[model samples]
Target: MRIHLVDGTYELFRYHFSPGNRDREHGATLGVVHSMLQLVQDGATHLGVATDRVIESFRNDLWPGYKTADGVPPELMAQFPMVEEALAAAGFCVWPMVDHEADDALGAAARKAALDPSVEQVLICTPDKDLAQCVTGDGRIVQYDRRRQKLIDHHGVVTKFGVTPESIPDYLALVGDTTDGFPGLAGWGARSTATVLSHYHRLENIPDAVGQWEISVRGSSKLAATLAANRELALLFRRIATIDYTAPTFEHLDEMAWTGPTPKFPELMAKLGGAHLVERTENLRRHRDDDRPQ
Candidate 1:
């Protein structure tokens, strides 16, 4: 069976900014939970959603400017705890990340789920560049961009980024991710960064001399000099983008499968002003019962 892992943090942000969700109360979190449940209803058996319980992760200590909750609105931040509680009450496996962020949890879960023999595929439900590193060659792990409705495999990564999935962290390091607050080396843009990193596969392996480059790329000399000058910073940035695959472990695929809502779902839904969800779930349960052979 295909195991689906979701980046709840990204989903919340997407829904918050989405046109259809702007005026709804707690719409982002409710929409995210609804969307995830729809996935299960549509045949996703094993599912997991990772959320950022605390915006600041250990990575913040590694880099002072890493993304944090400081700039997030009070309304948006307030929904995080509610989202986690709602997800848990719904009987979905929610990883409310504390020490690590949602991205790291998703990556770690993907790696762990990919190891299970019963899992036919592991679809990471996010377009986050950092999560791209988790894509594997065996087709076990892949990324699904819900907004674009694109399923990005290893080959797709190469097609989109001009480099293999393995080179993504390195590529992002050179191009920089403003969302994450890591400034890449100067003079590195998408094309130049892809051209060089595609060949070298990593920052450390790139030849120091421009003339030594095996593949001919534009502005090779300038790229080399920039790399030489900011080698340490570039590596540090890459480290920030790279996902840690060893955070939490899940040995069994069954651990992730949907088991229906928790006992406290009724009360929790009431608190979140999600009475509609509770009613729908009860109706769904009744329908299932009515369908069962007597």
Candidate 2:
């Protein structure tokens, strides 16, 4: 069995800006529900989606500049609950993350699912750089980019990032991610950061002296000085980028199984003014019933 884990937060953002303006109020919710259903129709058996119930997380207190709800558009923010309800009404397992962000939920689910003997592969459905660390070399857990329609395994991570999956957090920390609101050390770009990190494999391993470096990189002096000056900040940024697998309490794959929709799914859909979603739920139920012995 292959387990599919989706980053609901990213999907919501994508549909919010997508053209056609299909729905002013419920377009994102409808898009994400249809997308997940399509995945199931495409043969994904065990699936899970993680959404950010609250934009702020424990990481916010740890880092002053971590991504916050302050910058998020009100339109997009308003659709989060409706999206969760739509997914649930569609007979899919949804993790509406509260204390932890969606990234953490994805990471935790991937790690937990990878341990199950019944699961052959775990596909993390996102292009987030932070998820690279969870990719295993044996193809057990891989990252899938829906936009590019590509599956990035461990080797792909090394090829794309110029460093192994293990080095991605360190790489992102030094380079910084505007999406995550963590600014890395100054003077660090893709080329220089990859060169030094690919050799050292981590921030702590890199020496402060430029001459002591084993690998060759352009402008080693400048890179070394910037790293030395902002070493603590770089580490902190890396911590923010690293997904916490230990946080969520879901211990077994069985815990995530989709028994069916909540009892309130019908009423919930009505409250959101998504009557079409109610029809989709009925269709899903009929399909499931048809698969069973009659």
Candidate 3:
């Protein structure tokens, strides 16, 4: 059996800028709920969606420039609560992260689901780079970009980033993550970062001096000096980039089960203005029950 874990924050962001939803009231939220329902239609019985109900996570305190809800349209911000409520009402296990970011929940879920013997594969439904570290060696866990229909396995991680999954944080630390708002040291760019991290596999593991460096790189003298000077800062940035698996998402895997929508689903559908979604959900619920093992 396969379990599908979604990043609700990414979906909501994708829906909001999708060119069509701006006109419809609560359209992005409607599209999000509808998109999950389509997953059910496509044969995902065990599924979970993690949302960032409040955009300001503890990361904001760690770094002042960390992402916040400051500039997000009130319309988009307003839909977060409703999205959690509606997804819950629709019978999907929803983890609305507040203190931690949404990816933390996803990492926790991926780890827990992989421990289950019945779970043949776990598909993390997001394209975020930080989450790539969650990919496993056995290929039981992978990242899926639903928009592009792309699957990123462990090998794909190496191919795309020129480093192993374990090196993603180091890569980000050197190259800097613009989205997360930590500026990497000056002179570090994608190619140099990937080349060094690919060999060292971690910031700490890299030799501090250019003379001791094993790999050939362009402008190694300047890059090596910058890294040595900001070694402490680079480590802090890596810590920032790494996902916290121990963060509270849920107690057990069963908490993520998707039996069917709750009784309040009809009301939620009404509020979200997606009546057609309610009908499809009801039909799928009945059919799902019928197919369940007695």
**Candidate 2 residue-wise lDDT, 37-121, digit = tens:** 6776566667889999989998898888888899677878999998987787667778888888888999989988888889999
Candidate 1 lDDT by residue in tens digits, 65-157: 888888787778888887888887887788888888888889999888777687789999999888888899888999999879899999989
- Candidate 2 stretches with Cα past 4 Å from truth are 258-263, 270-273, 292-294
lDDT of each: 0.84, 0.84, 0.88
Per-model C-alpha RMSD: 2.2, 2.0, 1.3
* Deviation from native of the Cα of residue 258 in model 2, angstroms: 4.1
Give the Å shift of residue 259 in candidate 1.
1.6
TM-score of 2: 0.92
Distance from true position, residue 275, model 2, in Å? 3.3
RMSD of 1: 2.2
Residue pairs in collision within model 1:
none
For candidate 3, the 10 contiguous residues with the lowest summed lDDT are 19-28
Q: Model 2, residue 287: displacement in angstroms?
A: 3.3
**Runs of candidate 3 exceeding 4 Å displacement:** 22-25
Which 10 successive residues of model 1 have the least lDDT summed?
Answer: 283-292
